[model samples]
Target: MPWSAMRRVIDVSGDGGNNSGPPVEQARGRSVAERIVINGLAIAKDHPPFAYAGPVPLEDYYREAVIGGPGAFVVPAEDFNQFASAVRRKMIREMAGLPSRPRMALAD
Candidate 1:
């Protein structure tokens, strides 16, 4: 199927980086170019420290990894406590097609 014809998103979440599938950066780039938003949910618990060293700040990792597109976004749950809420909010935002915002004026 043509990339532009894609209407749904593929949300992938995991506790570690690409150890089992295709490289993430390459996948993300293709998705972005096709106008497909890729939202991510990364778990920081229950993993080897070395392999999952990830971002010193976990949010930074999500920002760089999971959310990459014109309107891509991610929600870091930190621990399980925040998982439900984060997922809910992220889903709402994605489904709603981002919130309406004021237009910014650019200087000519």
Candidate 2:
């Protein structure tokens, strides 16, 4: 991005938490210091062979680790099938620069 831009935003979404990287809070803090906004869209699963269906919920992890800055949000996708719509809504909010809202999860 251009250096003249007012705000730099990085949207990060994943199925796992800070497993191998530095502590999530550290990265989030660094991004915040740089005046960069971070948002999260976590695709969590109810049950199955997928690794997402583990002990810790991905949504909670994202809310704690990946989301920061003003109006940041973490959209949760409880069902894998609804992942597309979750991404759509998240993208809309990010592109529109909408205000932060309560966490939203796509229903089955």
Candidate 3:
């Protein structure tokens, strides 16, 4: 079958916010319109000091700007050491087509 016929997903794993290219939200909107699910793995390092301490938390940035589509959600890694576990869980959730419960969102 062609790619469009399969379960489509875009897994965006990063340590910082969207810094280049078209705005992430725009890309996400397009992908979501195509019936693709977007999930995020936010890597927040505690050691070596986390940079880009902007107004928004890293996970919140991913939630607000990077991830979209049905059942989209973020898996946060407190540090590099936790990346493996976080990725594993994120993959399982994706492969299982599970929707995140009590989805997190920025306050209105």
Candidate 4:
């Protein structure tokens, strides 16, 4: 939260739906308006715990709905097991502020 910080990013990680709070698009828009970058990490199906794919194409939804600003992106985790690695990749990209390809695949 430092004023001198070069980049401001708010990472939003979750499964495919937004069942609470403001809609994903609305939040992404607001954050972009505030000069903050928004990135998403979509968790795939809970095969181990629940055994079902996500209700939607999370990576696609995230790209269109949850991420914004210059070089913003969404990373897809194949499942909960891939969450940590996907997050790590996302953090590296965001912190570096590098201009990456329009789409990035964060796989296991």
Best by lDDT: 3
- Residue by residue across 1-108, what tens digits does model 4's lDDT show? 456856688888987577679777887788899899888888767555654354557788788788899888888898888888998998887767754458877898
Could you give the C-alpha RMSD of every candidate to the true structure, in order shown?
7.0, 9.9, 10.0, 9.4
lDDT, each prediction:
0.69, 0.80, 0.85, 0.79
Model 3 vs. true fold: TM: 0.79
Compute the lDDT for candidate 4. Answer: 0.79
In model 1, where is the ten-residue run with the lowest total lDDT? 46-55
Q: Pick the candidate with the highest TM-score.
A: 3
For model 3, residues 13-69, the per-residue Cα lDDT tens digits are 988877788888899989999899899999986555666475798999998898998
Q: Show the colliding residue pairs in model 4.
A: none
Report the candidate with higher lDDT, 2 versus 3. Answer: 3
After superposition, which runs of candidate 4 have C-alpha atoms over 4 Å from their true positions?
A: 1-3, 46-56, 98-108
lDDT of 1: 0.69
Number of backbone collisions per candidate, in order? Answer: 0, 0, 0, 0
TM-score of each: 0.65, 0.75, 0.79, 0.75
What local lDDT does model 1 show for residue 10?
70
Task: Check candidate 2 and list the clashing pairs.
Answer: none
lDDT: the better of candidates 1 and 2: 2
